[model samples]
Target chain A: MDEEWIKTTDKKIINLIRLTRKNTLDYINKDINVSTKTTRKDLVTNVDKSNEQFLVNNIREIDPKSKILGEEGFGDNVNSMSGHVWIIDPIDGTMNFVKEKNHFAIMLALYIDGKGILGYILDVMQNKLYHGIFGKVYENDKEIFSPKNISLNNGLMGMSAPLLINDYDNMQSIAHKSSGVRIYGSAGIQFISVIKGELIGYISHLKPWDIAAGKVMCDSLGITVTTIDGNALDMVSSETVLIATKIAHKEILDLVK
Target chain B: MDEEWIKTTDKKIINLIRLTRKNTLDYINKDINVSTKTTRKDLVTNVDKSNEQFLVNNIREIDPKSKILGEEGFGDNVNSMSGHVWIIDPIDGTMNFVKEKNHFAIMLALYIDGKGILGYILDVMQNKLYHGIFGKVYENDKEIFSPKNISLNNGLMGMSAPLLINDYDNMQSIAHKSSGVRIYGSAGIQFISVIKGELIGYISHLKPWDIAAGKVMCDSLGITVTTIDGNALDMVSSETVLIATKIAHKEILDLVK
Candidate 1:
């Protein structure tokens, strides 16, 4: 993507995200009926589906040729990361949305020919939008500086419930070594915490939409975005994801092994 | 205290809490320095001491017979809660204040003749206040009804860092059974979440001041607030505190045993 074209796309995407925010708030202020998803613990709501459709329609109008991989099945049947692809989770942390009415996020990512070109994660309740175009990342409009490479022993970490319960990848030990642990129940919110230095790292099992935008934002800040074992993640599947500062990543990976 | 006298004192305490808010915000917006308390992770700032003094001075002027037990040493040294005793944690979650600039709380409670009479927990950054006098509780000015007595399997739970890592009182198993686990790093914030029905319960090792205000608030809602083993908490020392909805309390106590 050329510089001018990239800038134009970024502006359009930002506008679309702001529109999504308005729609989400409208639904929340009104009555919402929630339903369960895959398991008794997993949740989905009418608002989630409506939000995804709204985002998909706008995104399609912005770039008709682009393929969308959305959480609510309103997007294209995408299999390969070829050409232009927009991945979105209209409402990440659906459980939080249904239960707490906070801590949920809207995330979107654009990849061109297998390369990430842009990303956005909006913390709806807080009205904080973290975005990155190519190598530049910003929170709202202010440029964010990379935090010091603090190690696990000196910083806080975020973990998923399933991983902690099962001791998957020795996560229990990794959590024990970190200064402390936090679980906000949202991948996008957790990513924002790591980027802002509020949390040193975050690990969880995430689908592509759950982490696509967050990964792009982290990459721009030189934060480590990889598997729990320091391996590359498949962008099209659910995987154990880890995002952290450089030293914290190394420390966590060492413990996982 | 009789109903008429209690109602009058409630109004006065509420006004005092609102006034204390202004002073705390002034310190936060200004440039301030922080120092460590017992450990590197434990922190205290000048803002904390100033807030405590401000609250104490106002309380003293409001009621001269009161004995204050404050986190800072400015309050009167009272060994027994036999009279009008005020317990205050100037800034709960001090580490969060120095680091995240959020998730900290201001807590105050009044015990009349060893019985809790009034409580306040102010979420400074969000500007939300939860207070109760005797059996009536309010959030800001709106009255709060009792939350549903959801069990452990159906609601989120909060745990402390040390407790989670050590799996103390079989917390690991209890966390595994709950709908999910959350660690917001502040007992006051955790309590607010539980009272608001965002979390079903919260367990942590807390000092008297840390859980004092929260305990009083929970009591009004018919929520169970006690030790991990379903025993009454000592009002003058640190203990393993558990605050939860009724069914959740029984379920957790069973697991702990």
Candidate 2:
């Protein structure tokens, strides 16, 4: 809970994300040496595991007492956000990373005693780091202006493709009402768009790692991060989640409910 | 038909696009003066008109005898692609340019007696220009390799959101068949992705300006650009289009037909 601890952790996380970006790019481009945990024949599959391991190992060294939950099963099997909890999605949008090589992201969030203390989402291709320390959000070094809390009708939305196709909770109708819909195939990248006000919201069926960093960033911007049923989300369960500008939140909730 | 003519035209077009990028960004970011054909209070509306005018005027000087067809009505209303025809979409995704300031493009294509001679699609935000001359495609200075001719099941797809929602020609089912779907709100950007082999195909209802440049680039890369009905697309009308790898083209057509 100490301010000093938050500041130092923020610095370390940014550096770690940069390192992850370099190493991942190296691995993907086949520039990394095979001796450092991979076969040269197929570099993509090992990326999630190796990258998550890299993040977990560095995070462990940075905060020895914290419980880390990672997407590739490299960390603790955290079921509760008690004490110091670090939730990581080392290579979010793996398909995009493999197929497109452009829209995926790397994310980390730190919660202290169930309170989101810090979060980071690195849009690797764009080389932009969006983060929140305590309640203020920043893009790289500049503090982000709070996105206008526009309604669903006036804003662009992002959602998982399957949800829209299935019309889950009126998603097809929701897509119609929105100015447009974009599916970048990554929650972290979608969160960055929402944080920057390019997308007014993102709705997806997401796991804790998929939605955890987003919850921290959205809360910092006064954007709503909640379950589709308009309930608070615990940082453990997979749920249908909607992260949006405040008014869009209420509008989307009304339509789906 | 001359190689020298195509080479010179390519150089001139690239220079023109660089200038267009500078002016467009200035207009959007409010760095340009109000005297430059816009009122300071609302610049978004004027962008399409002014940008098209800029391109049209330059094209006239570059190739005096050529006929121009422009999206913003700055040029001819010709119904035929004959003798040195240039089609332009100065701001291909005005909604995106105004809404997200990303995923939009400036497209220009030259058709000589019904044959695509040269084409360009500049993804302004990412600063990528996908272009073709005769039968070769290049990204900036480097020639682009042909994308792997993957099947529909092996590749990602892009579609217009409305079509996907309406299930036009079983689009929702098609969504399930492909690896996944993305809706990026601009035909030109989507075309760039396909040219780069990021998306195997893009299906959309597009205007002449929207599909002309794409036709040229896709043809150069040996990618198939056709009507959803598996017919050739003449560069003079709006139509439901599919720009895909060869195998994926047949697969997608079989689904809809």
**Which candidate tops TM-score?**
2
- In candidate 1, stretches whose alpha carbon ends up further than 4 angstroms from where it belongs are A29-31, B2-40
Count of steric clashes across candidates, in order: 0, 0
Residue-level lDDT for A24 in candidate 2: 83
Candidate 2 lDDT over A1-257, as tens digits, reads 68997788788889999999998888787642222223221123577778899999998999999999987789999988888999999888877787788898998999888888888898888888988887888888999978898988778899999899999999988888888898888889999989888999999998888887878878878999989989999888889998889898999888997
For A1-257, candidate 1 gives per-residue lDDT tens digits of: 58898889789989999999998999986888788879877888888899899999998988899999999899999998988999999999887887678889999999888778899999999999999886988999999888778988778888887787677899888877776678899999999888888888899999999989988878888899998778887688788998999998988888888
TM-score of each: 0.91, 0.94
Candidate 2: which stretches are off by over 4 Å? A31-44, B31-44
DockQ of 1: 0.54
Choose the strongest candidate by lDDT. Answer: 1
For candidate 2, give the docking quality class from DockQ: acceptable
Chain A TM-score, prediction 1: 0.97
Worst 10 residues of 2 chain B by lDDT: B33-42
